[model samples]
Target: MLAFREFVRAAYPLLSPGASITLPCKSGGGGMRPWLMLILRGRTRQFVNEGAIMDTIERAGFEVACMDEVASWADVGAVAREVDACDVLVGAHGSGLTNMVFLRAGAVVVQVIPWGKMEPYGEGFSGALAAHMGLRHVMYSIAAEESTMYNRYGEDHPVITDPDVFYRNGSNAKFYWREQNIWLNTTRFAPTLQMVKRMRRE
Candidate 1:
C-alpha cells in the first residue's frame, strides 16, 4: 500500500496536494484530523436519507467528503490520492469499497451491508480485505425496516422473511445487489460513526 501510494504521488504530483474536499468540522478544535468519506452511489444502494447521514457524521466530529464529488475513477491517481487522504471510508457493499487499498494502515473502512443476508459477501468482499490491509473494519448491517426491500416485499415476503431460500439461485442475488437502495435510519447508524470516532482516536 505504501509503495502504491508513493507511485501515485510521484505520477500525479499536482493531485496529491489538493485532492481533499474541505468541509467544516462541527467540532471546533482540531489536531490530527479524522476524515470520513461517504461513497455516494448514483443508481442503487444509495442512502435515501443521505442528508441525515451527513448530519450524523458531522455531529460525530469528522469532516465529511462525498466520494463521487471528490474523486473520478477515470483518474486512478486522483482517486487514490483522495482516498489516501481520508481516515475513514464509508460505503455500501460494492465495487466502490475496493478503493480501500489506497488507505493508510489503521484507517477505518465501514462497509454498510444491505438487506437479504449479504453478510458473507460484505465480509468477503471488503471486510476481510480491510483487515488484510491493516485497516479497521466496521459493518453497519441495515435493519429490515431500514431497507427499501421491506416496503417492496413487505414483512412476510420470502425476500424479507427467508432470504436464504430467496437467494438459493445465484442469479436471484441481483434483486438485492442491483435493484435495492437503502433508507438508512441515521438514528441506528450514529453509533457506528461514534465507533469510528473512537477508533480514530485510539
Candidate 2:
C-alpha cells in the first residue's frame, strides 16, 4: 500500500507538495469519527434515493463526503488525496468502487450490489480488491423492489423473478450492467451502515 501510494505521488507531479495523505480522526480529536466517502453515479446504476442514504449515514454518525463533489478523474492526485482521508468508501457496484485501491489499509468499503443476481460480479470486482488491500468489505444486496428494474420489468418478469434463466445467454448481461439503476431501500440499507460502524469500532 505504501509503495502504491508513493507511485501515485510520483506519477502526479501536480499533487500538492508536502500534502499528508493520511486518514483523518485516527488520533481521537474533537472531530474523531469515521469519515465516509460516498461515490455518486449520475448515469447508469445510480442511487435514486441518495439523499435518504446520506441522511442515514449522518444519522449513523459518519462524516460524509460525496466522491463527485470531492474530486474529478481528471485529477488523479486529488482523487487519491481525498480517498486517502476517508475511513469508509460507499458506492453501488460500478467502476467508481475501483477507488478502493487509493484507500488505506483497515479502511472499510461498503459496496451496494444492485438488485439483479449481481453478487458474483460485486465480489469479483470490489469485494476481492478490498480484501486484498487489507480493508474491511461489506456488501448490501438490494431486494427486487429496491431496483428500478421492478418498474421496468414487473414483478413476474423473468428478469426480476429469475435472473439465472434471464441471463443464460451472455449477450443479456448488458441489460443488467448498463440498463439498470437502483432506488435503494434506506430501511433495508440502514443496518448495513450500522454494520460498518461496528466494523470500524473493531
Candidate 3:
C-alpha cells in the first residue's frame, strides 16, 4: 500500500487541494486509510497509516482530508462528508468500497487490487453501476509493482484457483508465481486498463 502512495506521487506530480480523499475509518485495521488521507489533506487530518506512507503524496502536491476515527456512527458521517468533498476518491479494495457512501453522486473512484487474479463476480456489478451513474471506476493493477501478499492479513488477496484456469496464467505453469509474467499482463491487468478507458470515455 505504501508502494501505491509512492506510485501516486511519482505518477501525478501536479496534485492539489481540490484532490480530496476520504480514508477508511478503521481503528487498527492495517489499512491505507490514515496515511493516504493525511498526505492528501496536508495536515494531521484524522486517519491512520499506523505510521505509513504520507511523505510520498505530499511530494506529489496533494493533501489528505481525514475524518474522525471514533467508535460511533457520527464518525461514519464525517468520513462520508469528507469523501463527498473530493474530486477523486482513491482507496484500496474493500476500504474503497466503503467510500461509496461518502462519495458525491458522480465522483470518480479508483480501486486498487492485486496484480494477477481473475476479476470477481461482485466487482463487475460495481463497475456496471459506476458506468451507469457516471462515476469512473478505475482499477489500479499491483502486478507491475510486485506486491503479492502483505505480512498482515487483508481482504485484497488474489483468488488464484479457479477450476477452468487453475490460475490466471494463460500457460500451464504448475505455480502461480512461476507464470507471473503472463498472468500479470493478461489476467491481472487488462480489464483494469479496459475499465479506465471505458470510464474516460464516459
lDDT values for all models: 0.77, 0.76, 0.40
Q: What does candidate 1's lDDT look like per residue over 1-202, in tens digits?
A: 4555445445655343336644322332455557777888777788888778887887778877777632457677666777778889999888888878777678899999999888999998888767766789999999999889899878988778877775677754677888788988888988898888888879
TM-score list, all predictions:
0.84, 0.84, 0.44
Evaluate model 2: give its lDDT: 0.76
On lDDT, the leading prediction is 1
Question: Candidate 2: which stretches are off by over 4 Å?
Answer: 1-30, 69-71
* Stretches of model 3 off by over 4 angstroms after superposition: 1-53, 66-74, 118-122, 150-202
User: Can you write out model 3's per-residue Cα lDDT over 1-202, one digit (the tens) per residue?
Assistant: 2343334334433233333344543233332332223212212111224223333333333344433323224555445445555545554443235444444444566555443453452267455555555466666645433332222223333333232454435442332333232112224433543354344346
Residue 140 of model 1: what lDDT? Answer: 92
Tell how far residue 59 is off in model 3, in angstroms: 3.2
Instruction: Pick the winner on lDDT between candidates 2 and 3.
Output: 2
TM-score of 2: 0.84
lDDT of 1 at 175: 78
Report the CA-based lDDT of candidate 3 relative to the real structure. 0.40
Count: clashes, candidate 1: 0
